[model samples]
Target: MDALPIAPYIPQHVKELLNVSIKLIRFQYIDYSGILRCRVLTASFCLEQDQNVKFVGTGPAALYASYVEGTDTTPVAAACRLVPDWSSFRVCTYAARHASVMCRIYETLNSFGFRRCPRTCLYKVLEIAEKELRCTFLGGYEIEVVFMDVTKSPPTPFKNVVEWSLMEGLRGRPIEILEQIAESLEAANISVQQLHTEGSQGLFEITTGPLRLMEATDALVYTHETIKTICDKHGLVATCFPKPSAAKGLVGQHLHLSISSLENDPIEARTVDAYIAGILSHLRAICAFTLPSHDSYTRVQDRRGTNGTWVTWGTEFRDVPLRKIESTHWEIRCMDGTANVYLAVAALIAAGIDGIRSGRKLSWGDSQKSPSLMTDSAREELGIKTRLPLSLKEALGAIKTDLTLSSTMSQSLVEKYIKIKTEEAESLEKMSPEERTELGIKYF
Candidate 1:
């Protein structure tokens, strides 16, 4: 159906987010890939507390078009939660875009079939984080994305060059849009760090200082929208698609996460080892969430023996599924700009936290080369178990059956995720491999 854009009273949502009285309400929805897309309206207590308010659709928010035909008739859908930390002023925000086009979006917190979408799935993960981890996860994230031409008329290499070379120095659709985003982020309580071009052509990365988990994710949502607006103004497209099915270049959102102690401690102790174990143990399965696309497998392949293996690990090799950095946390390399930011971050944190709570031993996988760079046997023995699923079906099977993971992660979320991913695979299966790769949306 028809989605009517609505932007009224959204400022009230923003006001509540800021005051100690209002809780943080997040408005969230699902796009075509069944990934959660969001717009963080605001965190607040009372509308009376503020006179000025701001609303925005973050980078993750730009994933869905308000006017897609046939499916997802509901557009105005929203889900809101109070920040676990703030019980007094209680900051609550809707993950909504405030445009009239979002009218059909469901708003009830307990609505059934609502959880069918990944947004709700994310909510479920947060719930688990609360009960099991027994710690409040707060911190900002660094997200990377690539912008380029994929409309098929022709590839514009210079546009990509301009995006990388001139983003911050000059002012254009890219910079102007990001400036609005930076402003919106500051208003939302998320801090912005510096960002720049990444390895792939047309690629860009935004690094925000460590944020409370809520604000960090919110920053992602805002950045997504700002980038989209800038692209549209310049008659360009900025996509978060994992492998846009085109040679436009690889696009994936990398997550740099650190968990501070809710218990007032600064370090997580062996929490690092435990987190590593859970991630490595469940990595093959985690691939379903991290890389989430058929085109992804192809991206992992080497052009001339340059690309190798099913999984790799390293402090250096970028191809590895798990990359430990000099910093306090690990950088998951397999994820691409393709998947949902909320979903990827939630899945990873859930897995990592699961390891911590269960006292799971994170076998320090090989540090020599990338997990993708090493032999399968060598990787497997060092707790690099379970080959990364080449197919979405395989990944679903892995996650669905893992007794340890299932106990913590929602089974409903699993079923819903599988349903969405299965449809994606089936749709792609209709086309030949060449056709699939050439669909040219942006990833493989």
Candidate 2:
């Protein structure tokens, strides 16, 4: 028998969703504060060919809502639009009758992306890297989360302690929860590289396979949502907060990145060297994006198994903030779950591209040991002259002072981000330690 043909006029993405029996399409975007927001539409409404059907109006303040209280800081008069990037459509296997598509914010329905939109900013930065530097990047992230049973008085974690990456850590219900999360993500077309327990109490890490920069970030956001949703079903709260448990351990969102020459050509030795050098040079400033919250600084001082405190790079060294995995591949350990993934990636890539343009030299020697362990003279010999910012305030100062880094992004965007984060840090500083942790748990 002959096969029936697909509809020629139907949008491919819509058709794919309809094929999977999706009844609702959710237009989603991550804001500057790293919170995911969405608007929903019936699949039939989205299937319309009209361009107006693809755009959803939102308030300008939606882009800068404060992290804690959800306060809107922007003027109320201006409005924005969410235009779905159909290419990023993915079925939400955990949510029946629903699908999700990442959206780009625009000033008007007919306009290009809004300058303040983190995702749009990232797209522009990636375009620069591909067009000007003749390079592209593949990136992956390690999502570390702690699950707490909110039913308890103090919200206790799983009573059992799970050793890092050990088989014995796989237990009954907790393991089942993790298994379901992995399977659901895989069903959503996100590649799950590995799932294992971390040393922290009730903490688990999911390693996702790398994709091109944009897709990888999209996957990271979706992964966070999936983890939260599946855990809620099991009567647990999953938080990616950097310091969810102050006494137990910290959580991180370690990033792995690799660079490639355009068209699969061999990347030059100098290009690779400069890229790493660029990142190191701007490490402190980049922290403003990668580690944005006051809680994030808690991880910096605890060097036992946390991100190293000093600014340096080393080969195959977990203690260093930056680890050179190979010539073109590297691991950044300082990043945490508090960051907007889009802005973080954009800053990192822009720094690397800046390094290439300036022909920045790799002046620092590879450290055989953590900078803290080495003698001052030994560190000086290796040109390890700087420390990662010690606090959220200091990190914001670093961003403010680094004109070279700020020049890469839109001036208004940088100012607004800095203002928002600065206010958040100030507000967080007023709360008691317990209050801060509780708020982190509630919203993260």
Candidate 3:
């Protein structure tokens, strides 16, 4: 109906280049499982007056249920249109002739629109944050991915280098690919705060600075695509799968978040407290969207050292699911690459908005010790009674019963998401641990 919001501010040079030199446009969106999907068009076709919105078959909406196995489901069995948000356009650093922009799905080229779209869902949550709380959500991600040499029968780690954050860990093609990924990200106007090796073999992390909610999610998708594309060009596979192998440690999509008033001032303490409280209250339910796969639970469970099993928060504590950072932001460590970035972020913000609106008290105290280590009596004393869902099915069950979260995110979308994930979780349950891990690597 209304014009899309103006693109976040970009450098004048980039703006000039995009207006004059961009030749092709890619309309990109992520399915429920965070897989990147795209449709390409010539710059001329995109600029035509009649081509403002492009048609995309509705099959992608059921991507979570049918993408891995070509089965059509009800929620996405029809056709939809992709309406590109010109404001979100960015030059494709990996492809010199192409540029990309994010899109929202619509039921028709001219209509009220499809409300169940993942991007639309996120935008709705952001609007609630802005209108009700008078605060804008800001976020960034620490994305971890593992590189593998797929030439082998079973993809092997790209290299044996396992030194954490060490330059020596990236020696041959890995270093070159990382450098290119960094360069490509910057070229797309996505700031790279840091890029370093992780503790696992062939694993690395890229940290980006915060942007407004939608922009941050867009950047994250592009970041994943850039890394994967570059690795492919180098004849290696880059997977953000939560746990490609038990022996190589876990991969996480750690989210850092903050809030600011409409006037751009930092939010007050009460607001921050309420927001964090909301997240804690709905943490278990929200995991259905954040950690959407059976393998995701395996990576987050106790003994993974990822701070996933407990529902606790603390300042600078790595063993807590929600860690307060720099006294200004919070990091959610339960998520992984399997999550649809849009859905994950939307559910999180929606839950936080509920907290702010309800003025819910922040109950959980700072826990220096891991929940796994705390005695049952000690945990009871601290009021840390809740545990995160240990399986995809359990997480979906929690979501189905969570009134605040389910109501905030529309019941229709939540129900569809649960159905799809339930099927996936049940299917995975029939397999052995090794089989499950292999399937995770293959699909995620």
lDDT of 2: 0.82
Candidate number with the higher lDDT (1 or 3):
3
TM-score per candidate, chains pooled: 0.68, 0.93, 0.90
lDDT of 3 by residue, 1-444 (tens): 334323323345544555688777787877666677787866666555223333434444533444444333545335566766656778889988788888776653433355567888888888878877788878999999898777876676667568788888888777788899999999888999988888888899999988987899889988988988898899888888877865557889999987778875766888888888899999989999988887787666665568658888878888778888865588989889989988998889998898988998888888777878889988877769899988888899899999778778766678767777776677767778777666666656
Give the C-alpha lDDT of model 3. 0.77
- Which scores higher on lDDT, 2 or 3? 2
- Quote the positional error of residue 263 for candidate 1 in Å: 1.7
Instruction: List candidate 3 segments past 4 Å from native.
Output: 1-20, 49-65, 70-77, 108-112, 263-266, 432-439
Count of backbone collisions in candidate 3: 0
List the RMSD of every prediction in angstroms: 8.2, 5.0, 3.5
The candidate 1 region of ten consecutive residues with least summed lDDT is: 81-90
Whole-model Cα lDDT per candidate? 0.52, 0.82, 0.77
Candidates sorted by TM-score, best first: 2, 3, 1
Error of 1 at 162 (Å): 9.6
Best candidate, TM-score = 2
Tens-digit lDDT string for candidate 1 (206-316): 777766564565556555655665555555666665454334455556566665555666656676677777677677677677666666665455321222334545664
For candidate 1, give the lDDT. Answer: 0.52
